[model samples]
Target: MSNLSKLEFVALDISGKNFLPWTLDAQIHLTAKNLGETIIDDNETSLQDKAKAMIFLRHHLHEDLKREYLTIKDPLELWNNIQDRFDHQKLVLLLKARSEWIHLRLQDYKSVSEYNSALFRISSELKLCGDNITDEDMLEKTFSTFHPSNLILAQQYRERKFTKYSELISCLLVAEENNKLLLQNHQARPVGTNPLPETNAISTRSKHGRGRSGGPHRGRGRGRGRSNTWHRESHNTKIDGGRGSSRQNTGRPHKGRVSGDKDNICYRCGMSNHWSRTCRTPKHLVEAYQRTMKEKGKQTETNLIEGAPNSSSPAFWSDTHLEACDFIENVRDV
Candidate 1:
C-alpha cells in the first residue's frame, strides 16, 4: 500500500509505448479492490477512491498542464486531457528530429566508422519519429554522403547488384586498410633489406665469409693478421639503400698496397693508413667510441658500488675482448 502511494505520474511519451497518466491509472484500477473501489456507485467512498487515483495521476504535471486538468474530476477525463496536450508536443519533437537528420553529414565525423555510426543514429531517430526508412534507402543515402574522392568508389559499388549495406561497409574498411599499408610501404624500407646494387651484397658476403673463417681466400693472412687485414672498398653501400653518402675514406691506400692487406683500414671511415680508433673523419664514430668507453666506466663503477672486488679492477681476457670488439665494429660498418 505504501509502495502504491509512491507511484507518481510522469508524462513522457516513448514513441509507440505507454506513458505517465496511463501507468498511474492502470496501477490504481488494478489495485482498487484493496483500496475499496468495488463498493458503491456514486457513493462517497467510491468517489474518494477515484479522487485518490486522479490526484496521483495529476500530482507531477507542470502548473499549466495541471490547471488544464483541474476542472476534470474524473481520472479518465484528466488522462484524455493530458494526452491531447502531449500529442501536440510530440509533433514538435518529431519536426526537430527530422531537422537534425537533414543537417547531419559525414564531414562532421573523424573517420568512416564514426560517420557511418552517426548516420545510422540519425536514421534510427527519424524512424522513431514515424519516418518509414528502409535499409536500401539508408544504403543510398550513406553512399551519397561520402567525401567526393570516396564517392568514385561508391559509384563503382553501385554498378553491382545484390550488395547489402553491411557488405559495402566491409568493403570500405578493407579499402581503407589497403591504402594505409601502401602508404606505409612507400614511406620506409623494411629491415634486413639491402636494396643497393646486387654487387654490394656479393662483395659484402665474400668479405664476411673470409673474415669469419680467417681463411686462405683472404691471402691466408699473408703474415697480415687482424692488424693488417684488408681495407674497406671505395663503395660503402648502406645496409638499407638509405639516403646520405657513405663515410669517405680519409686517404687512398699508399698507391701500390695489395688490396688483400687492409691492415691499416679505418673501418668507420672506410679509409686506410689509419685504424678506427685513430680515424676522426666520421663524427658518428667519435660518439659511438665515447659511448662505449662510458658504458665500460659505468660497469666498473657499478661493481665497486656493489662491493664486488673493490680493491683492484677486473682483468679482461685479451682474445675474447678483441673478438667482441671486432663483432661490434662489424655491426657499426653495416
Candidate 2:
C-alpha cells in the first residue's frame, strides 16, 4: 500500500540511498496485499491488480524519481526496472562511499566528536555495501585521523598499543577537557565573551571541511566506543497464535545502523515510524503533537506542509488517470 520502506525513505532522504533489502521488502509487502498476488495472472482482475501495484509504486515515489520508469506499466516490470537501475547505481554509490573513507584525512575536522561521527558515517555506508570493516581497522582509522599537531601523541598511542578503544578515547577526552580548561584560564577575550573561542573556531573549521582534504583529530572522547549498535528492542513481548514473540522496533536507527523495522518509520514526514506517508495521521495523534509543540512553541504544522510546487515537482503527467499516483517530494535544500 505504501511506496518506500521507512529505512528506504530515510536512506533516500538522508543519504540519497536505497538499501536493496528495504526496497525489496516493500515491493514484496505490496504484492502480498489484495490483488497483488495476481500480478502475474492474465485475467482482467489480475491485470487490474498489477495496475494497482503499479499505481502504488508511482504514488509513493518522490515526484522526481517517477520519471525514470514512467512508461513502464507492469508492476513487476516496474519493480525490476528500478532494481536494475539500482544494481548499477548502488555500486557507484559504494565506490563513492569507499572513496570518502579511504581519502578521509583527520586534519579536515576540528572536534573529535565531529570527526568520529563522520568516520562512523562512512563506516556505516561501507557496511551497507557489504564491506565489514574490522575492529582493528576502525581503531587504525581512529588512530590515523589525527591532525599533524597531534602526530607525536598519536605516535605515543602506537607505542602504547592500548587494549581498549574506550580507554584510549577516555584519555583523549581527558586531555581535550584539560586543554579546554587551560585555554579558558588563558583566555585573551573579556569574561563576557565565550570561554573557549578557540574551541568554537575549531568547530567551525571542522564543519566546513566537507569536500575538503585534511580531517580534524578528536582531542577528547565525547561518545562511547563504537562497539554497540543502534538497535534497541521492546522489552514487552506478546504471543501471537502461539508464536514465539511479538515486538515493535520503535526507535529510528542512524544512517550507518540497521534494524529491520520496515513498518516503523514514515518516509514522507521524516519522523516516527508506524505510519505511512500517503495516509493522513489520525486526528487525535495530530492534536497530541500540536499540544506538545504548542507548549514548546517552536515549529508548527505549516513547516511540514508541502509548499507551492516549483520546477522540481514538474508535471510529467498528460493523462488524468495518473493524477492520484502523482507525488511531490517537497523540495528542500541539501
Candidate 3:
C-alpha cells in the first residue's frame, strides 16, 4: 500500500519509540496535502483524499508495522488503530520528562549556555506532554541550583525580580564574561609583583648594569674585592684536591651556582656564586660593604631631598632613616 517513493518524515518504528513526533509530522503533512480530513472519523472526506492519506501513512511506517496493519484501507480506521496501539507512549514519555526536570540543576553544568540548552530541551519535552514550565519557574530553578558560594549573587539576582528567564540568562552571561576578564587581569600581573615606578625602574637598571659592566666601585676599597676573590679560588682548589681528578675535571668554579638562582646570591659582596650563609667574606668586611651602600644612598637622597627646608630638618632625617632601615632589612633577608 506504500506507493509513495519518498519519505516525508521519520518512519514510525515497530516498537513505536518515536510515536509522538511521528504522529505530529503525519498530521501536518496530511493537512498540507488536503488529506487531513480523511484521518478524522465521520469527516466526510472524498475517496481520492482518503486513498492519498492512507498511502502517505503507510509510506511512513516501518516495514514490519505496515505488514501488521496490512488489511487496513480506510485512513480513519488506520489512524485510530495506530493510536490505540501506541497511545501509552504519551504517559511513558511524560513520566520520563518529569523525572528529568526534577533532577535538572544549573550547577551541574560548567557554563550557563550548557545549562540553558538542557533546560529548554527538557522544558520542550514537558510542553509536548501537556506540562508547561513558566518563566518564573525556570528562574527559580536556576537561582536555587546555584553553587553554594554564589548564594549571595543568586539572592541579588532574585531581588532584581526578573520576569523572564531570557533576561536572567543574559545577565548571567554578562557577569560570567566579566568574571573571566577579571581573572585574566589578575593572572597577567598578580599581587606583589607590580612593575616599579619609572624613576625606581631606571635607578635599578643602572645599578645592575654598572656592576655587570665592571664600572669603578664608588666609596669602597678594591682590597676587599681582591681578598674575597682569593678566598673563593683557594676554596675551589681545596674542593678539587679533596674530590679527586675525575670530579675536578667536570666541576664548575662555583659548583652549586647558576644564573637563575639570583635570589641565593650573596647580598654582602654582590657575588652571584654563593649564599650569604656560607660567604667566606669576614663579618667586618660585610659591615664595611653595607656602610658603603648606606653612604651612597644618603648621597642620592641629598640630591633629591623634598618636603623639607634643609638636610637638618626632621623630615629629611626621617626619610634617610627609613631608607637605611629598608637597606638593612634587604641584606638581612639574604
Candidate 4:
C-alpha cells in the first residue's frame, strides 16, 4: 500500500546487504516502475552496474535513507576499513595462488596517526593469512629494533589493547645508545705489547736536568725556598735603604744645588706669569679682524639679499645693515 518507488526499495535492500531481507516481488516492482521492465530475469548483470544503479537510487531517496545506511563522512576512515577488508581478501587470494612470502614495505611516517594507520593496514593485511602469528606478535616483530619512543610505545601497546605508531621510534634510541657505547669502548692503546719502561709515577725531579736548561729548575722544596729568599730580600733593610734615598732626593735639590726665582709676570705681553698669549687683555688686532669679517659678512649678506626677489624693498636693506651693525658692536664689547 506504500507509495514508495520500486528503485527506492531495491536501493534499501542492496544497501542493507545480507543483513536485511530481499523480496524479489518488491525488487521487480521497483524495476518495473523505474526501468519499465523487471531486472530479476537478468543474464549476468555486472555488480559494478548494479552498484551504480543502486547509488542513483540512493541519491534519489537520500532524505529517506537512514544514517546507518550512509557511508562514513570521512573518506579516510571509510578507506581504512575498506583497505583492511581488501587487504585481507587480497592476502587470502595471494596465499591461495601459492605466493611463498607476503612482504609489505611501508612508507616512512612523521605523524603518530599516519604510523598507526599504516600499522593498522599492515596488521589487517597480514591477518588475512590466518597464520599462527598473533597481532601482538606481528607488532613486536615489526618493532624489534630499538627506538626510544617506539620501545615505550611497544611496551604500552603490549600492556594495552591498541598498538600505537609511537612504538616505531624505539629503534632510533637503541641505535643512539649503541653508538655511545661503541665510542666509549673505543680505547687508544699503546702499540707495543710490552709496556714502556715504567718511569717513577711521582718523580721528585723534573725530566729536564736541574740548571741544565735556562728554564726554572725543578727539585723538591727548591722553588718554594727560592721564592721565600726573594721575598725576604725584597723587603730587607738593604733594599729599603736604596729606595728611601731615591725618594728623598726626588724633588729636593741635593747638596751644592742653587735655586732660581720664579717669574712675576708674562714675557710676551708684560702681563701675569700666565703668559702673554693667554692674557685676559683682549687683542685690538683680533677685534679689528672680527670687524673686517663682520663687514665682509654684511656685504655678502646684502648682496645675497639684493639678489633675492622677495627682498626687493628698500626697507629690507636698511633693516639688514642695522642688524649687521648691532652684531659688530656686540663683538667689539666682548
Ranking by TM-score: 3, 2, 1, 4
TM-score of each: 0.38, 0.40, 0.55, 0.19
Q: Write one digit per residue (lDDT tens) for candidate 2, span 1-334.
A: 3543332322221123564544655556575666455344343556667776776666656566676667878877766656665666568768988999888876787666676678778887778677887667767877887887889989998788877666676777788789999898878755544443232111111111122233243333544222222222334422232322234434543234354565576543334644553435544555676676568757556556655544444442332245322554544421
Model 3: which residue pairs collide? none
Q: Which consecutive 10 residues in model 2 have the weakest lDDT in total? A: 200-209
TM-score of predicted structure 1: 0.38
**lDDT per residue (tens digit) for residues 111-189 in model 4:** 4344445555555434444444455554554555325656685575456544643444454346556877877756443
List model 1 lDDT by residue over 1-334, tens digit each: 3644553444434341334334445556536534434222343446666766666555545566666556778765665555665555545656876787777765566767876787677676566557876768767766667677767776787777534777777776788789889989876755544343332222332221122345455445454343223343445332222322234444544333234545666556656775565554646655686676667655443443543443344433432335466657566665
Using TM-score as the measure, which candidate wins?
3
Candidate 3's displacement at residue 207, Å, is 36
Judged by lDDT against the true structure, how good is candidate 3?
0.78
Position 190, candidate 4: lDDT: 33
Q: What's every prediction's RMSD, in angstroms?
A: 29.1, 41.5, 22.6, 30.0
- Candidate 1 clash pair list: 228-263, 229-262, 229-263, 230-262, 231-262
Residue-by-residue lDDT tens digits, candidate 3, 1-334: 3437888689999999899999899999988888888887679878888888888999999999899889999989999999999999989999998999899998899999899999999898888889989998899899999999899999999999999999999999898889899999889864755553333111111111123223355356554332111122232233333322212333546453244655566888766766675566655567888887777755433466545457877767776655566657576676
Q: What does the lDDT read for residue 158 in candidate 1?
A: 75
Which should have the higher TM-score, number 1 or number 2?
2
